[model samples]
Target: MNAGTTAERVYDSLKRTLANGSFAPGARLEPARLAQELSSSATPIRDALNRLAGERLIEMRPSDGFHIPRLNEIGLRDLYRWNEVLARTALRMSRKSEPTGGHHIAPIDAADLFGFIAASSGSGEIVSQVASANARLAYVRHVESSIIEDTADEIGDIATAFWQRSISTRMLIQQYHKSRLAIVPTIIELIFQDTQTIR
Candidate 1:
């Protein structure tokens, strides 16, 4: 077991840890240490780090090594803003003859819901970046779960419209995204506070 494991397997495991925020932003991702923890060798860990870097979840420094991307106000805003644009494009594209039904959606989970929309965007880059950003936002979403829950209805309506092919309601999707901007300011402040306490 010394040679230890597959790169793809290591990548998946490390990605889960990163997505769950087990490793805070800017935390060094030393392959040797990670390999030791995973009961493997550094080779797979290095491979995993490269894959994570491709998704923008980790940064590879020139002289240093891999580290999680640092979270900040600018980065947080960029994540939401980009998610909005990408998700909007995806929803519009994924829009076909919507299924007819009164199926109810679960309460709002911005990270997850928007991740779904972005997944349909038909663009690999868009999907990858959005997923990475959502992973970063998962921790914040957990902390501010209540403040964001108010979006449940609006988001549900948007999802319902998408499902039912209701043109009238479908147009409301843009408004849903625009309305989300209002919370960005507060989110910015919260992320700033949260990152400050990280170290």
Candidate 2:
């Protein structure tokens, strides 16, 4: 394949690994090792890492190379807060007509549900930001499912409210973030344990 294609492919793979918490927090990402494992040259791996760093998915240091960002308690809370704000903003800006409840009860993935809410705003910028936040929080949400009993129900409620155009949908979105915020420590602990186990 061409150089551009190779770099793009490497970028996608690395983004998934980082997003899913495959690497432990603050783990160094050596492009040479990644290139060997991925069966590509180090150049593309470095290129991909640079792109991910630009998105804030990976941290790049002049002397230290690349690493997965370690989200502290405050950082985690701030990320969640940012996502909550983005979701609420999207909902408020959406001019979509009231839902007819045609597909209100269909099963929905949590990330996709969030995407739907964001896309409703009719703003490409908002959609892009929400997608990035969702990716960054993907593994955190997975940890939530393992620890929180009502995650599915909570997400489902939000989806239902959106489809039904309930006035309380906004409230459900707030509650969702509030509930997650309450368990930030537990989420972090589980994520750390999970990454440690795989090491």
Q: Which candidate has the highest TM-score of all?
A: 2
Q: What lDDT does model 1 reach?
A: 0.67
Off by over 4 Å in 2: 97-108, 195-199
121-193 per-residue lDDT for model 1 (tens digits): 5567767777777787666565555466656677677666656656754467567555546676676566556
Error of 2 at 131 (Å): 1.4
Pairs that collide, model 1? none
lDDT of 2 by residue, 1-199 (tens): 9999998888888877766656766778988899988889999998898888899888997899998887778999999999999989988997667432344544355677788888778899999898788778877777888877877788888888887778999999998889889999988888788767767
Give the residue spans of candidate 1 off by over 4 A: 1-5, 62-64, 95-108, 119-129, 143-146, 151-154, 168-180
* Count of clashing residue pairs in every prediction: 0, 0
Best by lDDT: 2
Task: Give residue 147's error in model 2 in angstroms.
Answer: 1.6
